[model samples]
Each structure stands twice: as C-alpha cells, then as structure tokens.
Target: MFWKKFNLNKQYNILYLDYNATTPIDPRVLDAMLPFLKENFANPSSTHYFGSNINESVKTARIQVANLIGADETEIIFTSGSTEAINIAIKGVAENYINKGKHIITVSTEHKAVLDTCKYLETKGYEITYLPVQKNGLINLNELNKSLRSDTILVSVMYVNNETGVIQPIKEISALTHEIGALFMADATQAVGKIEIDVDDFGIDILCLSGHKMYAPKGIGALYVKKGIRLPAYTHGGGHENGLRSGTLNVPSIVALGKACEIAEQEMQQDAERIVSLRNELENELLKIPETFVNGSIENRIYNVSNICFKGCDANVMIGRMKNVAVSNGSACTSAVIEPSHVLAAMGLSDDYAFASLRFSLGKFNTKEEIKSVVEILKTELEFMNS
Candidate 1:
C-alpha cells in the first residue's frame, strides 16, 4: 500500500496532506503534557495535591479551548471528542428547549456527527429540516429563512465543510437564526485549528471542536456554549462540567489539547497562508491534467483542504495507485460505505463525479516540495487509469 511507509515504524518519509481529517500532535503540546501522564495524574474532582495539580491543568485547558474560539472559559466543557461534543450540543439543546420548540434546522452537507444526532432526535419526535445546498455545495440562505418557524428552536451548521474545505457564511447564517429566535450551533471541528474564530463576533450560541484535528491527542475535545444558554445534560453523573457533561477529565490529553489550542491561536494565520498556497499549487497543477476539477468554492475555502474530482478514473482505483500520496477517497467516516461521496451527491454531482472525488487536506508540516511531488504522483496515477 502507498501508506505502508506511514503505517510502518521509523525512518519512513511520506508526505501527509490530510490535516482536516486530523493533525499530528505538536511537540510543544507533548512537552506540556508529559507531567500529567508521568507524575501529576489526578482526578480533577478530588481535593489533594494530585487533584490540585490536575485542577490547574483542566482549568488551563478550558481557557485554551476558549481562547482558540473566542469563548469564555466557563462556557467550554470537556468531552471525549468532537463527536461527543456535537452530541452534547445538539441533543442537549433539543431536549432542553423542546418544550419551547420542536423544530431544528441543519444543512444536508453537515458531518455525520450532526446528521446522526439529528436522526436520533427525529426518533424522539423532534422535527428536523435538512436544508439543501447549491450545486457549488453551499447552503441556501433563502431556504433557511423559509424553514425557520415560530416553533424553530435551533439551527446547526458547520463552520467548514470537512470533505470539500468550503467555509460556510457563518456570521450571516447566525444572524438569520437569531432573527427567528432560534439558537445557532456550529460544528467548528474543521475550523478550530485551521481558521480563526471569534464566538462573540460570529454570534454562535454553541460550537463543537476536536483536539485531534489541531495536533492534540485523540479522545479529547470541548463543547462551547454561550453564557446563559441552557442545555439539558445528556451525560448524567457526579455533576461535572458545570452539570452539563459529567465525566472524569482526560488530564494528559486535556493539557495537550490546551497547548495545541495555544499554538493554533499563535500560528493559525501563518499556517493558513502557507497551506493555502501549497494547496493552490497542487490544484493548479492538477488543472493542467485534462480530467480534474477542483470541487466546491475554490476561492472561498479553508486553507488546508482541497477536494478534487478526476474525470475518467474511479477514486477507488485511483486512490490505490497514488503510491506517492496519502489522501482519502472521501471522508474517513464513510470510507466503509464504498459508495459515492454524499457531500458530492448533495451538490448535484453525478454518481461518476461523486465516486471520483478525493480529499487532500493539508497541514502545518506540509511543504512546497511535498505539494509538487503529490501532484506528480497524482498525474502519474491518472495516466495509469485504464478508462
């Protein structure tokens, strides 16, 4: 396999362009987290030296998550990952405010985290409106306006599309949701480390983010809820996370996440400038090939992602032949589905176009040379496609 080198242990060198999927943990984050795993491990709720030390780390991590997204420290609650964070955000709101309104709104292009959560809520009798997107893969705001009713309690959208790297018009969408008196929730999973976010300016009531996508270890994330926004507790026990999410915190992972968030704040713009240029270089080169078209709004996308749909080759076959590249056919979540990308389908793309899609997400460690090499590898593989 092309990724065998990355799969194997030491000394292997393969370029990675899948940052929107997940990022490598920064060395600085690991250093800041060493003590928690080695010596200072504590159950943050306890009252002792071990606990006191962890208390500081947990508090610091909360502040770090808040700083990255421009939210208040008290508003951030620790979770297992963005999936759980999203679950808490959506389900929490659905159950808490169901009495006021049972209608919830979200776009069809949302990650499975939001969709599956809403699907579960649907079983509970909540009305969900899956808004359609344009051929370019953007949600229709006019349709959103029409969907909002007096009984609409929440509207959830993603700040960034994970597959295509398209950025949603969050500020405008937030304003629309507010006008209808519905609370707005955004899954900022793809935007947390790669883009800048100011919760107050964006006017989002709740947001979800993952640490692993921004260089923190997996199994640790946070959910941000604006002050005064009440959500019912889906996770019940021992009254942790201010009675919102009750669970023991992952100290080492939390510390790592906090440090990762700090790095994201300090380096996000520079990283974006570099990654965007590299992604463009790769995409521009792909344009030289006869059959490839960059998916979504190329000009209005996150710096770290590019979804390319090649004309003649199937992604399954092309994906296997790109021995010099590490990319995905669609999303990691739906890889097992073996079907055309749902994101592409929602954009009104034909099955051929959808099945031919590939996602190449760049990251901080990516370089110009790597971009050129990946493009060459793709070209070579495209030539090898029989059809």
Candidate 2:
C-alpha cells in the first residue's frame, strides 16, 4: 500500500492486511535508522574506537528489545531474524548441551521455524511430539501435560497463532512446562509489540522476536535466553552476540529496532485500542456478506489481525478482486505455493473454507476509511462472484 501513494493513477486503491506476514517500518523508526545507515556507519564489533562507538546504538536497541519483553539486556542476543533466533533457541539448546533426555514437545500449529527445526532434529535421533491444535488453533493444556515426560528437554509453543490471531495461554503452559524441569521456549514474533509480555513473570526460558514485526528493519531480531541457562551457541565466529550468534552486528537495523521498541513501549496501549477498533469495524462491515465467517472466534485475538473465510470464493480469486489490500492467504512466509494453508487445515477447516480464508492485518498507518472502502469493495465483488 505504501507503493500506491506514489502511483496514485492506479484504480481501486490498495489496502494491506498482511501485518501477520510483516509490517511497514514506522517513519520514526526509519528516521532513527538513517544516521546509522549513512553517516554513522560502523561495525559494532570493530576494534577501532570510532566505529566501536556504534555499540552505543546497538546497546540502546538491546535495551529497547529487552523492554518490550520485560527481559534483561544480558538475556537478549541479536540474530538475523526470528527464523535464526528460533534455530538458535532449539538447536543450540538441544545440540550443544545434550542430556540423556532426547524428547521435545512442540505444537503442530507452530511456525515453520519450530516445526521445521523439530523435523530436522528428528533425523539427528531426537524424538519430538507434535501437539495438535483445537478447531480454533489453540493447543490443549491437558494434552501438552500428557505429552511431557521425564525425558522431555524442551517445550516450544508460539505465543500467538500467526494465521488465526489466537493467543495461547502462555502463563499456564509455562507454569506446567517448568514444573517438570523442562525448558519453555516461545516464538514471540507475532505477539511482541502488539501485546503485553514479561519474560520473568511469564516463566519463559527462551523467546524469539523479529525487529521487522515491530516497525524496525528486517534482517534483524533478538533471542532471549534466561540468565543461568547454559544453552549452546549456534554461530561460531569472532564472537558476536554474546557468542551465541556469530555475525557482525547489524548496527543500522539494531538502532532502528531499539527506536521501534521505544515507540512500541510508549504507544502500545493507544495502538491496541485504535487497531482493535479498526479491525472490529472491518470485520463487522465485511461479515455483512452472506456465508462469510471468522475462522477463529478468539475474543482476545491480536488487535490488528482478522482472519475471515468466505465460503465459496477462492483465495486467489478474492485476492484478485480485493485489489491493493496487501493482505495474505494465511501466512505470508508460506504463500508461495498453491497449497491450501496448512494452518487452516490443522485448525480443521475443510479445503473450501481454508482456501477461502484471507488474513487482514492492521498497522500504525491503516485508517478506518480505508477499511470501510475495502469492505464495500468486498461486498461488490462477492455479489459479482455469486451472480
């Protein structure tokens, strides 16, 4: 949609609802990053004193990231993104510090980062239990408890369902996980900046987040591993990111992320009220069409996300008709294929409904007028499709 303002001649102005996939960088965030990219270019790992000055920006970002999750700065380790942070969280913990225990537990509805990582670990002789999702894409606490055994080393669950906007019962899960002395890991990529979180109060041992998700630049994110936890390192280089992830620290993106976090900390409450209201208005208007239903009936779903399933219209057809609405099929990372989203299938949706699901994600810039017009367009298109 950002591209549309420049090309105003295009008919049917576009709307973006794919915030679950990614969000546009807030202008303030971009402004904060400008100096690091252009003038203050410096490697945070450099030995020279001048370039090393960039570490201040990186440290500030670290505090910002820490603030969002209620984590300590020492607990945060910078990485390329959520995918990399997830890899470090799981593999680093599993491989470097292998115990006699080889059992791990993760939900079937987990992001590809968790599921795919578990699958790869399977080849390495580790046993994993893929927990099933309820019809609403939430895992059963009893089932999770039943799966945990004496040999369980880790339990990874996402804090929020990316496709359905379902928020998991993290406190309950974390409490149960720690009771058995197993580590609890959370892929907080979808929850951070949009919801409230606290690392210590929630009993989280490991957590992953993406800077891009919070209005910062992509190619940078952070992993939080609680202090006193001896997880193994994934990256081996000149020792960056506490030697957990080895790379020259991304100074520019790091600075941007810190600034984004600062803004998120200050504006989270207001943003939640506004974004949630916008999404609700959107759902109310669009649901006026016959045979369209919300997939997950979560009362406490993320404020910016609304997953709607139009019974007959194909996702591709809907997308074609919707125009510049930068929304998604289910998940943006997995939209490259013709597959009916695995997430919807896991949530027990039939192919017809799953294929019809569209994710509209809101951001700091989305307006109510834009949402209203989007619904009007959908109403017209649905009528045409039915005709």
Candidate 3:
C-alpha cells in the first residue's frame, strides 16, 4: 500500500553516509552507457563498421577521463579499478626502474594497495621506506627528506587517506621525489571527482582513480601516466591501452566513467560546498556528545569526510544500534578484518581509539535533513552505549 503512493525510483530510506566506500551510479551516467551495452556491442579492435563506431566512443571516453585530471588523452589507461591500477603503477615502476634503483618510499598511512605492493617488492629484495605520520595524520616532510636515497626509484603516496580523508601534500612530495630522480605516484581513488585534480599541477608522475568512488559504475577506473614515463605493461596480450594494459574494453563501463568525470568536472565546486556544509553540521552535532573526538587533521581533511572516535563506545555495537544509517568504521576493503584501522594506528592513535572510530563520508545525493537525522540517530545510539 505504501509502495502504491511511493515512487521507488526517487525514494530512499537509508541515511547513507558511506560515499567513501562507493557512490550510487548517477542516472545520467547510466543513460550515457546504455547504448554501448546494447546497440553498440562491438569490439573496439574489430575491423568492422560497428567496431569503428565503438572505437570512437572509447576514444572519447579516454579523453573525458584524461581531461578530468589534466592529463593528455594518450596518457589514460582504463583498468578494472583502483586496486589494479595501483598494482600496475607500483609493480611496473619497480620492474622497469629496478636498474635505476631498488628502493621505494611511501607513507605508513597509505592504502593497503600501495603498502601490500611494496611488501611484495620486499620479497624480491627491494627496500621500502614507510614514512610515519604525525598524530594529525600528516607525514613528516623532514623524515621523508631523510629517507630519500640515491637508489630510490619510486615514491607512492595517496592523494587522500580513505579512512581519515587527510590530503597529502602531493605537490611538495612530487618535488622531493623528482629531486631524488624517483618517480612520484599517487592513488587518487578517494580524491578524484571529490576534489579538483590537476595531475600536471600536482607534478604527479602517475595517478590512479576509481569511477565507483565518483558516481560511475563499479569495475571501471583509469590510471594517468604522464607522457614519456615508461612503465612495463601490467598485462601481456593484444597490446591494448597503448600496450600498457591488454583486455577487451568494457565499453559500457568506460562510457559511464567518462560521463561521471565530465559531470564531476562541471559540478565539483557546487557539490563540495553543499556537501561540506552538511558534513560540518553532522560532525558538529555528533561531537557535542561527551568524550567524542575528531580523528586526524581537521583543517587538511577533505570536505566530505569526518572520522570520529566515540570514546568508550564499540564501533561495531554503535553501528548496529543506529537504525536507518549506513556508515563504516573504516575502508570497505578492510571491513572483513576485525582489526583496528591501520590509518589511525599509523597516526599514533591507541588501539581503543582506532577501534572506536567511524568514517562518515557524504555525497551529492545526501540532504541536510538526512544529516540531521543521522546526527540524531548517532546521539541515541551513543547514549544507549554510554548507559
């Protein structure tokens, strides 16, 4: 009976504040991608009329993705997602630049993708220096400077910490990396589309991003390789994606990603202003609860994320008690593990504080009313926990 009057297409009941995990695909993106999936179902590599048209669509998508990050069209390489991109960037650099150096530099707060890749390299005898972060989740530049060695081949840092939303000083780090002749690579999955990214301006030699994080369909991502940077192919076969990657292109998803990037470039500023206001309101209200603390650098954080530690409260219990709200203690990638957040732990947070943290990330579709309701839900759940 309720569904008789309610339009399911536009209606939502869950107070979703987990945009960091992934965003719901935009309708516009779906609209743009449908043709590729249905009528234009042809291989881009095929020597036929359908293939020719599809190839043009793929090229257009590539340019759209490239333009979002201020990269040349030739520099974009589509991948399954950021994880794959990270693997390509890290392993490619390690393999190609091994002659130049067997050392890589990264921050302790980097996503597991970068850390695990470096760890794998460690098995091959490559040295990895994981620079620690200060209590505010900011890496120590001086420590970084000291860690750079003549043999350092790559320095991988994320543009934003997925859990804490703390933005790294990418430009400065890029400068430092170049000074040592090491390539600078960034996992920008959490930063791209949420913020303005100019790969050239940031001096980032390689950048990776996921379309799912920015209102596109999942399983679509792209890596930006600055021109002239040589990375060994991530996959071997048909030599697609300029021979850097080889696969039959997922044309529908690629088209969706391109459309999402186009929308992001056009609406980022407006979306940021609105989302930040809602995020601030929710955060301020939630922090009013006694013993609650904000995690990481408040000033340097991105507009849409607020990671808060509810002292003496169990994050899992609180989440379970809060009805109609969707939030997380940390990254979805690490949610299966019942462990404290590595990002918070890397910033010197105690085990209890790390376990008590919850990440609230807002998105374009969320409303101020939703933020208020989430705050109220949190308040009720926290009070119950305290009692």
Q: Model 3: per-residue lDDT, tens digit, 1-387?
A: 111232212377787899899988888898999998788899999989989999999999999999999999999999999999999989999999888989999998888989999999999999999999999999988899999999999999998889999999999999998998889999999999989889888998999999999999999999998999898888899999989999899999999999999999988888898889999998898888889899999999999999999988899878787766789997778889989988989889999988899999988888777787788878877777777
Give the TM-score of each candidate.
0.95, 0.95, 0.97
The RMSD of every model to the true structure, in order and in angstroms, is 3.3, 2.7, 3.0
Compose the digit string of candidate 2's lDDT tens values, residues 112-182: 88999999999999999999888878889999999999888899999988888888889999999988989
Clash pairs, model 2 backbone: 14-324, 15-324, 15-325, 15-326, 16-326, 17-361
lDDT-sorted candidate list, best first? 3, 1, 2
lDDT, candidate 2, equals: 0.84
> How many Å off is the CA of 170 in candidate 3?
0.8
Measured by TM-score, how close is model 3 to the native structure? 0.97
Alpha-carbon lDDT, every model = 0.85, 0.84, 0.89
Ranking by TM-score: 3, 1, 2
Candidates 1 and 3, the one with greater lDDT: 3
**How well does candidate 1 score on lDDT at residue 337?**
86
